[model samples]
Target: MTQADDLADEERRLRQLRLVVDITAQILAEDRHLTLCEALRLIEAARTTAGRLFPGRQDTFDLVVRPRLERIVLERFGIVSTAPVN
Candidate 1:
């Protein structure tokens, strides 16, 4: 693939990541019945989806996205240790 093709593909993947993360955040914020365990599972699913969308970018996601998600979980569910996610 050409350089432009690679860039376009990366952009598309980034958009997908954003969509997944945004939707997950919405669920976490709006789902009043969501338990802490369920919220954590949703975050894990988002992380896994992110890893599939951008291989070898776990650290990037941890730095850029995980904290936000963690904060939301903390706020919604109260104090909980952040666990390693696959």
Candidate 2:
């Protein structure tokens, strides 16, 4: 592929990654009570797409997706404290 084509592909992948992250954040913010299955499904989809778009870069998927999902799950289940102070 030409340089321009490669740049376009990269840009598109970046956009997709952003979308996935945003959606995951939205889901977590809207309903912290997401079930395990629901979280897995979302994570799996993001992982698959990320892996395909950026092969050999598992850290991108792990870093961008897994941490957020884990954080949300932990916060939702009270594994991590988010207590409010008055």
lDDT of each: 0.90, 0.76
Tens digits of per-residue lDDT, candidate 2, 27-70, equal 86567577767876777777777788889887877866787776
**TM-score of structure candidate 1:** 0.87
List pairs with backbone clashes in candidate 1.
none
Cα-lDDT of candidate 1: 0.90
Candidate achieving the largest lDDT? 1
lDDT of 1 by residue, 1-86 (tens): 99999999999999999999999999998899999899989989999999999888888989999889888988887776667665
Model 2 per-residue lDDT at 38: 84
Counted clashes in each candidate structure:
0, 0
Off by over 4 Å in 2: 80-86
> How does residue 44 of candidate 2 score in lDDT?
77
Model 1, residue 48: distance off in Å is 0.6
